[model samples]
Target chain A: MALQDKYAELLQTATTLGVGNLASTEQAGVLHVSGTANSTADYDALWALYAKIDPNMASGDLMMNIDIKADAGAQLKVTTDSSNLNIRSTPSTEGEIVGKAAHDEIVTLVEKTDDSWWKIKTADGEEGYAFAQYLSPL
Target chain B: MKLTKLLMVVVVSATMLFVSCKPKDADIKAAVEKALSADPSMSGTTVEVKDGVVTMGGECKDDACKAGCEKIAAGVKGVKSVVNNCTVAPPPPPPPASLSTTIDATKMQQVKDGLKDIAGVTVEFVGDKAVLKGEVTQANRMKIMQMLAAAKVLSDVSGLTDKK
Candidate 1:
């Protein structure tokens, strides 16, 4: 049987999980499955299904690049000492300050724009960019 | 020749002492089997004892069943320890109730009416779990979960927004 036909159920489960940026293609006789799972539970469920289909996963006929989406609410914390981290409107130090994330305050990560800046939201409804160095992902 | 004779006597005496100190494999095996048979969860598993080490090999309902077998073998007299190689098969999850491929129009309308602010959200039933997919802010996501929860439907919310 073809790789696609063999792992059809796995692909179907990924779709059912509502995975984002899903791309599946066959290359060199290996079915390449890639997607961003909305949560870790969703990612694990897909792997469990794959394991169920092939107990050993020794077919060497599948390549998976599924990743768990990191949107942990209030789990990420601001780790800067003493000084409050400025949550800016843009992902830059020069951007206007929309809010302040106090030292050690837990914030929700909106996204990491680059190596130096991250978009974050505080529990008090403050949302903007903060220096990535000050925010620790938990 | 005398030294060689002395060495042979010492070697034979050590072997005899070692053998005598260890419990017989048959006794340990019998005790392990008895304990296993007494437990309903581990009664079906096979037990083996060799030189005081007990080995269990068979299918078990879960990790607890596998551990129970190991515990039984460990508690057996003369058994040094247990090497539980029992394969644990997790219990099969309950079957999902049959769900319609198409979303019920009335139910969909009721959901939409309940959460008027959920713009562009697509709700569909995937094997008894409602999958909500669309672009929404963090606050909107929480509201959507509450609305879906009120409808008594298990849900998987996939955010189209970049934040999630």
Candidate 2:
């Protein structure tokens, strides 16, 4: 899809699924370069949104980046894992999910490399990248 | 000895008069500085005080700053009357890349929400028109007034002078 079309698609998804979790503001385009990939791959639309909002993040950094890129230390705590187990690439709904997370997953945040995105660990102690957008503070 | 004593008293009296009559204009300048420092919006506007007559001039970012300068001038202790000639200028905030046409409705909502996020403003938008209908601290009120004037919804905002 074209860049503008991609952004619009992401915007629509964010309006619906991101309801209370949606970001408070919008910003210009961003670029990405990371080595991580998603788990479930069901969150493609979400990753697209993230790319429009910010393009620099690697595929693995989606679930870990926050609204603003802070170098602060991160610690993740999983509060919920429902029917859908899709892992997204960016914080916004426009991003795509590259992987699937299991139920009752607890990911420990290791670092904050970009906007609200953090490095996390899965239930089986698998280290991966995620966006802070989906996780609540500990 | 008595002659010398008399000379001393005369000299002392002269000193007293000199101290008592020191320039109140300086006092007025200090007072203006004190008031402006306590308020941020008026920090940029310059105040010229001479012989207790204040002439204010500077380009503030908005009408609120202008009003703030005037109000501060009037309330200050040594001020006789303020000749507020302060000018209003736009902020250097970066221009929006593609001015996304925020709907009039969205404009009103953003105004209210934006004002609320910042302390000291109680903003309200009735219909498509936003009406800011309360008092904020003098400094904050000044800047807010300027924002209201520049606000897209309040493009035709008039009666700013009539309010005070």
Candidate 3:
């Protein structure tokens, strides 16, 4: 199913419910959302479990439906200049910049790596640990 | 035995090869849909890719839709390239047909210069007909249209119609 087709399907589903989106008058933005927490052991699993259906989210924004404080799954879209959010070669900040992000400026957090660090996407799409203070959506 | 070990190695490698080959068009299309659905950026478009050639056709809601679709299409595994036939919405009027070559060529120059700065707007004059290319954005495709309409009221070119 192409997204446009799926979007059409979703629009059809929305019309059946009488809700509409601000962007498209014929279509509705509201869709299903999982109101539960997902395990953070894996990145894909976490998103599959708790991603929200936001019809009008812009790049570099947070998933508005997920409250930061909610013990549930909150997926954050990185929307800034964090494509170069680097992790040092060693655990220490004094080390060299090992890798960089090759794609989207945003990254969703899967889990805390250690007391001071959280693993994030590196250049090759591999996950590496970064200091927790630099990560937000807390 | 030595033969058994060799057979086991060959079987495992072949299995890995089979699993990693480019999926069929149906499977690839399904994966593309799933991947786009999972991501928020690719929300309002339809895409079809066959044999590494992506055939994207649909009205994108905005420029973001165009850019987002292109970005996602670039990432699908085994995609050699894409043919972007996707149309963005809020479409601009089709260029006016040439009616005659008698309109003042200098006046057409002024109109062309005024509208070119506007993104996606193209202006061409054929006799009394002024063909506009590119649709409207936040800058207003109507701005030029309004100017032309008003100019007609003030000048001899008032006979200019968008339909040409």
Best by DockQ: 1
Which tens-of-lDDT digit does each residue in A17-108 have in candidate 2?
53222332232232111111222122333554554564422211122111221223434445322433345565333347655555455555
Which pairs of residues collide in model 3?
A4-B45, A60-A79, A78-A106, B120-B134, B122-B133, B152-B158
DockQ of each: 0.03, 0.02, 0.01
Reference-based TM-score, model 1: 0.31
Candidate 1, residue A3: lDDT: 82
lDDT by residue (B44-126, candidate 3, tens digit) is 66778777677777767778777777767768776677777777777532221111113464445445534544556556565
Candidate 2 wrongly placed segments (more than 4 Å): A1-138, B1-23, B91-164
Residue by residue across B65-138, what tens digits does model 1's lDDT show?
98878887888778888888999875653222112122465445545544443567776667645666677665
Model 2: lDDT equals: 0.49
Tens-digit per-residue lDDT, A26-136, candidate 3: 112222211112221222222322223212111101111111221213343332223445655544455577665432345556565432345665424655554433344
C-alpha lDDT of residue B48 in model 1? 82
Every model: Cα RMSD to truth: 15.0, 21.4, 28.3
Of candidates 2 and 1, the better by DockQ: 1
Better of 1 and 3 by DockQ: 1
Error of 1 at B123 (Å): 12
DockQ of 2: 0.02
lDDT of 2 by residue, B16-118 (tens): 9986766488788887878888877777777788878998887777988788878888898768889988888855433222123333654554455335423
TM-score of 3: 0.27
Give per-residue CA lDDT, model 1, range A30-85, as digits (tens).
Answer: 56666667875786578767657864343435555564566646366776646788
